[model samples]
Target: MPGIAVRTAAVLLVTVGDGTSFPTAAHLASYAGLAPTTKSSGTSIHGEHAPRGGNRQLKRAMFLSAFAALHDPASHTYYDHCRTRGKTHTQALLRLARQRINVLFAMLRDGTFYEPRTPRLT
Candidate 1:
């Protein structure tokens, strides 16, 4: 079999907890600094969602999450839905991120773990 790409959950699992142990995506996103950052420069304008301000490894994880959501069939379907709702790639990714955040939240809230049966990066 061809070599499979690495993944965020795998990394998180190794570092923190596996997919079985749920951790909020927001917690992960915040930990990764993928979450928005507020910065106002005297109303002039020079701001980004705060560039790279969290765990380097965890940030990588969110990108992996983004990539996975883009690739996974179910996630792709959701992305298409976002696109149909007039969301751009970035917008779609944000939407996907929001959804991922929910999944993570639910998993953690329920004290359930994520057990991906398929070779999923999603």
Candidate 2:
């Protein structure tokens, strides 16, 4: 929600339509091309990678939103965690986009406003 301003929110709303088409957040992620796909061959297997298919416009919007959201503390923390885990910048951003999809789905499904989560004190 931090990165999603007027234009970005418009793009998402237009792209997602009525939102009932997707039964779950995973469905939305897959439709937006944020879902990873595994490639494998005989006696060989490759790691999961983002698929080339799905709605390119939506995917681009999601990626840009994730990048813009880096300034947010929670998003920054998650991005840093992903980087520390050996994820490249792009990979980390993609993961962030995928993660945000869950929140977006919930908001859309429940017709609720975005509420930032408070940091828990350990």
Candidate number of the best lDDT: 2
- lDDT for predicted candidate 2 compared with the true structure: 0.92
lDDT, candidate 1, residue 25? 60
TM-score of each: 0.56, 0.90
Tens digit per residue, CA lDDT, model 2, 67-106: 9999999888888888999999999999999989998999
TM-score of 2: 0.90
Where's the lowest-lDDT run of ten residues in candidate 1?
1-10
lDDT of 1 by residue, 1-122 (tens): 01114655566555545433435566666665667767677867656564557767755555557656565666777778878888788767765665665556566566776543333333
